[model samples]
Target chain A: MELTAPDRHLIAALEGGLPLVARPYRELARGAGLDEAEVIDRLAAMVDGGLIKRLGVIVRHRELGYEANAMVVWDIADARVDDVGDRFGAFDFVTLCYRRPRRLPAWPYNLFCMIHGRQRQAVLARIDELGRVPGAAGAPREVLFSVRRFKQRGATRLGTAAAAEAAP
Target chain B: MTTFEKRLLDEFQRGFPLVERPFAAIADDLGVTEAEIIETLGRLRDEGMVSRVGAVFDPGAIGASTLAAMAVPPGRLDEVTALVNGFDEVNHNYEREHRINVWFVVTAPHRARLDAVIAEIGERTGLEVLDLPMQEAYHLDLGFPLQWN
Candidate 1:
């Protein structure tokens, strides 16, 4: 969906994040030069339009003691990847499941899922259980544990010009 | 965690109320004042327990993005990482235990710009960039339960 000027302003105001206060829209409205009702309506519309995935809290998993995190990649048959991905994504522990192109001769895994656990053993056991499941049984896979998080931030949007305008 | 923190993490991670006064609505449901709810969230954010209270946009929805990885030599890991992270598009960068040690996500306003950034990284780092754009997202929810042991 095409973002209007107001939508861009709203996104800019929200780039940092929603304020930790009652009537956040009121605060956002002041920045966007829109009324509180307009801010609420536009945000709701954005959510409905799929531009905004969800309006919620972003919990830091590591700080919460989910120390073991692994990005599991599978080499499922091209024909079966979709079915298998759907099944794997249904698991409560599978936080992210997606299909990406495989760079052959180097990277042969296309299907990827992220699993988080309290310990490495827990993550490994869950991966083992996942392999034994019906859809993904015997699927060739590899688990890459995250050794360090160099940088992690929310996605950048609107563009450099708009982003610069949003900066204080 | 205290009961308030626990409740905030559990209930507010997803399905947050989209209203003019969302905090007030949340306060009414949880039997707390709006000010108290706001204070708790502020503290949670300041403590780095929560990243933000906002929308998690779908990747490539408004901007183009791809997951790129590089096999940096062990010795030059730090230097190469600095080069990769120098770009604004490189948002999520991680060190994974594999031959392809460095993985990062690149995002731009358009597909062409995204490609240009990836090419620039390859030129600057002299590393073969493995650009794996998301073909399909089976499940994309970022919110998950925070289980404590």
Candidate 2:
């Protein structure tokens, strides 16, 4: 959906979060230069358009005792990748799953899923169990545990420039 | 965190009310006063337990993005990291225990812009840039269901 000037203004207003109050949209509408009703309607439209993936409390797993985060990747055969990926997504612990292009002679793993737990041992154990899935039995896989996170922030591209221009 | 806080975090990861009084709506469902819900969320944000209470836009809808990696030598890891982080396009940069140690995500408003950023990084770093863009995703959009123990 092509965003209108008001839509950009409203999204920019939402970059941080909704104010925890009785009438949050009123606050957003004020910032976006729209009225309360339009702000709510446009936001609902954005969600319906598949632009806003989710709208609610965004939890931080690591801060909530999920310290060990592992990106377990698999080199599944092209024909069965979609099938396997679907099955992987059904697992309760698989928070994220995606199929990406595999770089030849360097990175062979294409199917990726994130399994985060409080203990490294538990995460590894879960990965071992995941490897036992029918079509996943013979696939090559590797787990990359996060060593350090230099930067972890939301994708701010949509609003950064627009917000600045709208400011003042 | 209180039991109420856990329930709030778990149950409200999505389906936030788009009404004029959203917090009040959440309060009605959770059997808490609107003021209390607001206060707890504020505390959670301070503790980093909650990133925010807002819309998570589809990054693809916003721009083009890819996961890129580089095998930076140990001595130059920090230097290389500083350089990479300097780019506004790179949002997540991490060090993992592998030969392809330094991995980061790059996002740009257009495919050409995304490619130019990756190419420039390869040139400046003099390293093979392993660009991995998503071909398909089987993601569950409801967000993570917290296992609060």
Candidate 3:
């Protein structure tokens, strides 16, 4: 996407996260040298253009008492992955579900989902229940528990200067 | 949890206002002053309950990204992990309890650059990298109910 100077400035301001104030756009506008309405308009436009996804609060699952979390990988039959993924994703406990390419002779799982709970046993019990679900029944799966988080951050914004240089 | 905090968590997971004064709109909906709403949000962030009040961009929408894993020897875990994190493209790194102990998401401005970074990580660490690119996301939106017990 071709970003104008104000667009770049707006993104730069947002990259640090929205300001905590009664008038966040006013704060952003001050930093970006744009009008408060322009800040809102540009952000709304970016959301529409897929440059920005939904503007919402990013909660810390572990801190919120969801201590036991597992990334479950399923090796379902290739033909049935899409159907199975959809069914699994609909479950309230499943936070994330996706289909990924499996690397042969090393990684054998293609479908992945994340489940979180207050206790390890509770998470396991939920996984067992998931196993009995129609589409997931009898599918080979492995659970990888997160031991530690090394880093977690929002997406990196490509500076407009660099983006402009890359553009034709 | 305070009623104000509860309301903030419940109501603002998604669909934040897109208007001239979003906090004013939120304050009106939640029946609180705009200043109070902003203070609570600030406290939520400072307490590590909230990461950000911003957009979570779609993966691979603004850049190329892939899930990569490495099986590092237990003794060399720190060394290899530091090597991987040295790259600016690496984000969301974690140590999982599995043979493939280290996993991370690498994102770059383009696919070719992303591939090159993955290859370079393999060369630097001397560990086979399993590059798993997401084919489809069944649940693209990640906000879920946060139950505090």
Runs in model 2 deviating more than 4 A are: A20-22, A159-168
Q: Per-residue CA lDDT of candidate 3, range A34-128, in tens?
A: 99998888888887887776787877777677778899999988888898888888889998888999898899999999998889998999899
Off by over 4 Å in 3: A1-13, A26-34, A46-53, A157-161, A164-168
> Which residue segments of model 1 deviate by more than 4 Å?
A161-168
TM-score of chain B only, all predictions? Answer: 0.89, 0.84, 0.87
Residue B5 of model 1: what lDDT? 75
B16-134, model 1: which lDDT tens digit per residue? 88787888888898888999888888888788788888778876676678999999999989998998888878878999988998999987667877889889988988889999999
TM-score on B-chain, cand. 1: 0.89
Clashing pairs in 1: none
RMSD to truth, every model = 2.8, 3.1, 2.6
TM (chain A) per model: 0.87, 0.85, 0.81
Least well predicted 10-residue stretch by lDDT in candidate 2 chain B = B140-149
lDDT of each: 0.83, 0.84, 0.80
Of 1 and 2, the candidate ahead on TM-score is: 1
What's the CA RMSD of model 2 in angstroms?
3.1
TM-score, A chain, model 1: 0.87
